[model samples]
Target: MTVTQILAAPAAHTAGTAGPVRGRRRALRRALWGAQILIAAFLLFASALPKFAGQADAVETFTRIGWGQWFRYVTGTVEAAGAIGLVVPRLAGFAATALIGLLGGAVLTHLLVLDAAWALFPAALAAVCALVGWDRRAETRDLLRSVAGLPRR
Candidate 1:
């Protein structure tokens, strides 16, 4: 092949492959967003709302935990905030990381104070949050840098 044609071959190959790579990235991003939305919805409607509304089961659970009803409100508020944060593009990673911590506590509480088998739910949630946090590590780092008054990379 001519010198020009030889040098152009890799560029041509890359250009041809770029479309599929871009498409796959887009699909993966969409899937991640879908998972985030579903988790957020569950947190908001199924978990936080019940606590906020003073539902019987939530009240009973908090009572059993021996932290008083006020703790219930605090937990509900944190969950609600985390749920909202998961939907925010810039804050999703930080939110997910926070949720992982919260879920960790939940898992422990379930194992020690509540039903051991019930720990699985929070454990599963924490796993998903870990995935989200890892995927958005760049944004989380940028957020931390900004918080510390350092310039983002």
Candidate 2:
């Protein structure tokens, strides 16, 4: 083979290979975004709304935990805000990370104060948030780096 042909071969092969890889990455990113939105929406409607509306169960649950009804409103606001943040592409990772913390608290509350079996729902939500956070680690890192005034890698 000619020297020029040999030199160009790998470049040609790589160019051909990159397209499918990029396509798959795009699809995976979209899927992760969808999952984040779904989980966030679930948190907003099922948990946050009830708490904000002063639903009996939410009130009772907080009362059972020995925290005041005020705490319920605060928690509801945080969850609602985080849910909205998750819908923003640039903030999704951060939002997911925050939700993971919120869910972690829920998990601990269930295991420590409430029925241990009740922890499963929060645990599952935390796992999903972790997944989304992991999938968006690059964006998360970039955001943190920017916040810290560090140069992007």
Q: Candidate 1: minimum summed lDDT over ten consecutive residues — where?
A: 3-12
Q: What local lDDT does model 2 show for residue 21?
A: 48
TM-score, one value per model:
0.84, 0.80
Residues 2-33, candidate 1: write the lDDT tens digits: 42332233332544666654455445567778
Distance from true position, residue 16, model 2, in Å? 8.5
| Cα RMSD to the true fold for all candidates | 8.4, 8.5
Relative to the true structure, how large is the alpha-carbon lDDT of every model? 0.86, 0.81
Clashes (backbone N, CA, C under 3 Å), per candidate, total 0, 0
In candidate 2, which residue pairs clash?
A: none
Worst 10 residues of 2 by lDDT: 3-12
